[model samples]
Target: MLPPVWEVVGAGQSLYEQGPVAPGTSTQVIADVPAGSYVALASCGNADSTAMWASDYPGIEEILALFPLTSFAIEQGATVITVPAETPAVPVQQSPSFGSSQSE
Candidate 1:
């Protein structure tokens, strides 16, 4: 069996102010994950800029006897994955500043 596909999703500041999407990003990955138990990490990158970051959500033990286990290892051990520098989700939030509204 193959590992379940995981989709990484989040919202954050854009590296470039004139990009199409702002404060939002997502990605997907497919791996041959085992059925008994395993761990996976999600990586994120700036939509506009090339800078990259990662995060890990562990304890994702899937109990399916039919699945197959493939030897896999992450580059880095378990740790709080780094995400694009953006406004804090809780506690505080920040937005772009505008001098004045443009009249049409």
Candidate 2:
């Protein structure tokens, strides 16, 4: 399973990023970004700026399991934006049976 990643994006550009951090673990990310409105997002895979709006990816399950995001702005000085400590629930896909169409 791919680990989660943290990203701060604005105007279709990535301002700051942290991770592919291990699952069930946390880390600190500090970056001096310009003052602007940004959106913080976390995902259980390596979905970067390039694949921001991608509908389909290799591991759609990981992409689909995303954390809650909040938009914020930094007027000046230091700013601290936090990604909530929550685990994304990855959906399990059941394989189809070609042998029989009837339920047992």
Candidate 3:
């Protein structure tokens, strides 16, 4: 698995660390982001292992079927969308039902 790139959308800022960071190891990256509700993308760059196993599949079409290159090739990385800080509560009214009535 390749290290992922995290991009902050609408902010034009990104953070990345080149790694085959060892399992259980930790790393950090920082980027200045502007304030606003937005999303981020986590791109795993190129997943080289797809071919290592895919080589056994035997045909171009067959390999592609198992491992979609689009998933591995996406440059946009991953996304981190923001949730609205507060949601306004809607005031629901109890509607009155009409009952049968005898009238002149």
Candidate 4:
């Protein structure tokens, strides 16, 4: 039998990401990305991101299973990406209605 494969390839870049997908919970795979960046895509749990995954929702039977996690690393010469500072959200206020009555 051949080993399961997950291919994520793009112009000279190689990727083989895999993992499980649990209900209502997201799977996050973090990686160090460098400057002079190109568009990078992240997928949590999906048909395209699994090796031998099985799920009732999508009707897949397991062939070979993984605990559901993957790793990403930046190249030695590439700069790592950083998280931006969070900003507070301002509350929105609505105008009050005049003389309104309702019955159920």
TM-score of each: 0.22, 0.29, 0.27, 0.25
Tens-digit per-residue lDDT, 1-104, candidate 1: 32332322223311212224345563344334323333334333455544443332332223111224322233553332234345356764554454446554
- When 1 and 4 are scored with lDDT, the better candidate is 4
Cα error, candidate 4, residue 10 (Å)? 2.2
Candidate 3's residue-wise lDDT over 19-99, tens digit each?
Answer: 565556475664454444443333332357443221111122332455554433233333444445566699977645545
Q: Candidate 2 vs candidate 3: which has greater lDDT?
A: 2
**Residue 54 of model 2, lDDT score:** 24
For every candidate structure, what is the RMSD over all alpha carbons to the true structure, in angstroms? 15.8, 19.2, 15.0, 15.2
- Model 4 segments beyond 4 Å from truth? 1-16, 42-104
Worst 10 residues of 4 by lDDT: 55-64
TM-score of 1: 0.22
Q: Which ranges in model 1 have alpha carbons more than 4 Å from their true place?
A: 1-34, 56-104
lDDT of 2 by residue, 62-94 (tens): 433453432222222223344444546899777
At residue 83, give the lDDT of candidate 1: 40
lDDT-sorted candidate list, best first: 2, 3, 4, 1
For model 4, residues 24-55, the per-residue Cα lDDT tens digits are: 85655645533333323333344564432222
- Lowest summed lDDT across 10 adjacent residues in model 3 is found at 52-61
